[model samples]
Target: RYDVDAIHMDDYFYPYPIAGTPFPDDRSFSRYAASQGFSSTQRGDWRRNNVNLLIQQIKYTIAAEKPWVRFGVSPFGIYRNKRSTPDGSGSETNGLQNYDDLYADIKLWVEKGWVDYNLPQLYWEIGHKAADYTTLLHWWNANNFEQPLYIGQDLKRSVDKNELDVKIRQSREMSFVQGNCYWYGYLMLDNYREVYDHLRSQTHRAKALIPAYTHMHKGRPAKVKKLADVFTEDMHFLTWEHPKQPRNPETAQRFVVYRFRKGERVDISRAENIVKITPDNFFVLPYESGKSSYTYVVTALDAFHNESKPATIKVKL
Candidate 1:
């Protein structure tokens, strides 16, 4: 019953291997592998298939229940080493792989469109001995297959090496990489090495909307109606009404508020102009002395981040 935007699975599909000891799934494999047409020799394939089945089932369930809720995977950085794959469709780095070691066919899942997005955890520093961050970053970008790809960075490593700025800049340079997610977000909240200040003042100064899922739904929601300002002794706010229609893809799930100076053009496309994005229809206006007037534009956003036409209102203080 929780209202969640996405269902995410991290890199925990199977247990990491213990040296000189097997995974101890022999009994389960022996009991059910044959019924699925998997031979005893194909135990590894069977294990990968099990994870594949789970991914497919989750995709189907989300599509049926809430098509707007995206299904994404943050898999282990390396899919496979080149030496392990027959076709050599693997990265050059030699490391434990999601495909072989963890029995997760991440490439297959992405290619088959079974997941909405893939964020590979490349938690290594640049030019590392085993799994270099830049090497795997480029590898994932090349194999994204038009699916959204985000990088999962380790907060401590990036900050300690002073590569946080470098890594973010590198991802932005790549065409297919959409964004980056930090591991152990608390480090950022705690402002480790002033990383939070750096992001707020420089890298992420402008507000950005989540990328729209055009693959699922390409339609925009209807624009809001009756946009007006309300002024009272205790509070001054702007309020608008949703479009008169039944709840559907064309109905507003949230609203985007943008503010522009009196003489400036009302451009909703500019991320810097965005004041707030909220589910509530009302937005509290901050009082600013010496500011005589300002123009505010509100737009409706559907579940997929598609925005509607702007509803404008000018306030004179």
Candidate 2:
């Protein structure tokens, strides 16, 4: 009982919906079945097995990978149904749930100490008929995890002038839900200005990071060697090179460099960046320093936040 140290996890994978056939559970198991975990036709049971390995792997693997790190998942909220069973994790009207359809028994994971937290995707308006905030919220709070619980909200959904008002009020009304994760960071800028007010408000802002496993591996990165522009004063010029990435062995390889001036954070407020960053090989940084300086640094960022080592070039103004 006292052997383990921390929880570890991954996001919900394999999105729902089967094309023409139903969710391939029995079929998957029959065609590629190993020793059975449970004997049943309930597609939900097999689906649970699909995620069960993930949940178990998340726990043990985290212990193996980084024992001190905690793991959690933010599955689509509704857990299960009371009408179907005596004890389910949904409200009277809560629709098909993660446990039933998506086969994520997140609560079981929390209760069994398999996970450290559950960030339920509670992204609904306060009084919405199908999935009211008040009821589902209480359900989550009432069903406490041995770890912790957090809400993942759709802040962009609050961008509506009318809905934004209610969301602001609702934020003020809850306490036990702990903190929140705006569905995505861009939501902060996309939301109605008043919605920002609610987030910045004293009451809601007081609840900062919820206490949990805070340690994880963020690897040290390599440094920039040099930086210089290949393009001259000519406007539509382009230039690029690489360090770690292997270039063409049989032919001269081409590279595209997205240039920006020093000290320019990516501007998310607008549809694009403020200093006019471009993807066509090189970008013209319009600031005084950029116009004068020839040295510049370049880094890579994947569609996700996986950042790459910086490559640099040296030149004269």
Candidate 3:
């Protein structure tokens, strides 16, 4: 079986409502209502219950098989508007609500601890008339209900001067925002407006480990052993014996390699020095001949990516 890290579902729950039209699920609903202990009169409620059952069952199956595999959803940005659910509506946006319109009770799932994380699609700009990005960001952040919360960003808008910058800045400023999930990865890769370069140079200069979920798998992996530096084909490669234990919960799933300049102190905690997160025990050091000597450190990572104590070697260029 493949060992996947996480399973994510986006805003594909119930369809966004269309004017003067209703989704046709009556035949299936009527067929299973009595057997499922619900009534035909409760059609709307039945539909919502069906979606809930599906989400919960998926989570249960994944957890039973691999407790470390996370399950998350990216629902529509607005849960409800002030007019519809005055008590529970978290924002001023009048856009479609996942709760009322789509019958996907995202808040209940988060409140009941059914999801590992929730990434709502807050795709509008800062001052849009219907759904302001800033407004929905705070709304989602406040309503996370202890579950990890990440925002779904519109990557196409990232080229606009103040748009991506403000979104990233605000995310960094907010304590509840775990991170962001960019929409349309290909556009960023195509370097639309040089967004990729901008991100690499400024916002994301270093790699970060996915945040830990301590409740599930809470231990570090064994350290790398017998690390050695070898030069081959004009490339400096570091190969090491894999951690003694390699498959269980506490065993190494991959390795994190960090490289520091000769005079600088080696720090595994900082992401700037990190060269790679790889499954192989060997890593090619980013060394230029005639340049300063570099110190390299390698650490093992468990299924949950908890890093082990480092094993280090200093090499001359």
Candidate 4:
């Protein structure tokens, strides 16, 4: 798990098909039907059970390895369409549901303390005739338990009316949500400039550490124990060290460098400007003249995405 911080399982592993291809599940289905007494009409139910098992297993894997680390899953926008069942997740559109189509029992995963957080991909807006943002927001709110809840807004669909309502609701949800995860760190790139505007603004991401995952484990980094070195001659290099985070350190994949630019804490989130580092529980920033004009800090993020508070270094001018 050290390969990544925060298990960002997107709508992958099993993708929805194109017009010609079918989701090849005959072998799994036959086995499942034989083992669980599942009938053809009940295939969706069996599939859901399978996904639940996967979630539960992964949860145990994290617990056994590093309980405090974080886990996240970005599911399809619709869990279930209203017309399909009595307890349908009433949203617009008769689309494939995560609960039914993909077999992911997302809501129950949260209620049962299996997943650390959930970022439902609600790309539609409030006024949308189908799959309105308000509908899913309320639906998610009603079911939130000990875990965190975040909305995954899509950048491509951002400029559209239904997508814009998502931005409005995103702010509103924060009062109730843990945080919102922008779909792909890159999608909010140039292609989705309008939607990117909504996220890059100063008004967004107002919190530090989106509510703690109480269900996983509450672990803190050992303190910013020392600032070892600072260089400023040719370029600049600053180094700081600390003990491992609460979870097993191996699960940490990368670190985010934070610089106190004129007292404003700035994290390099852009692709071109950003520097990647191994999640070794230490931060080393190569000096850049125009980078910033303040102190520097470092934080560790594990594969399950347990982020440490900034370990600061004040650069002497």
User: For this target, which candidate reaches the highest lDDT against the unseen true structure?
Assistant: 1
Query: Over the full model, what C-alpha lDDT does candidate 2 score relative to the true structure?
Result: 0.53
| Preferred candidate (TM-score higher): 1 or 3 | 1
Candidate 3 lDDT by residue in tens digits, 26-83: 7888789879888768776777888999999999999888877889998988988877
Q: What's the number of clashes in each of the models? A: 0, 11, 0, 8
Error of 2 at 264 (Å): 40
After superposition, the stretches of candidate 3 with alpha carbons farther than 4 Å from their true spots are 1-3, 34-42, 86-89, 158-162, 230-236, 244-249, 286-293
Candidate 3's displacement at residue 103, Å, is 1.0
Q: Which ten residues in a row have the lowest lDDT in candidate 4?
A: 268-277
Candidate 3: RMSD to truth? 2.9
C-alpha TM-score for every candidate: 0.92, 0.55, 0.86, 0.63
Off by over 4 Å in 2: 1-14, 18-20, 25-27, 31-34, 40-43, 87-89, 159-176, 190-194, 201-317
Q: How far is candidate 4 from the true structure (C-alpha RMSD, Å)?
A: 6.4
User: What local distance difference test score does each model get?
Assistant: 0.90, 0.53, 0.82, 0.62
Evaluate residue 19 in candidate 1 and report its C-alpha lDDT on the 0 to 100 scale. 97
Residue 253 lDDT, candidate 2, scale 0-100: 19
How do the residues 203-302 of candidate 2 rate in per-residue lDDT, one tens digit apiece?
2543221242322223322332334445456542324533433221211112223333345543232222222233234555433434553434444322
Candidate number that wins on TM-score, 1 or 2: 1
| Candidate 1, 86-168: lDDT as tens digits | 99888889999998999999989989888999999999999999889998999999988978899999989999999989999
Ranking by TM-score: 1, 3, 4, 2
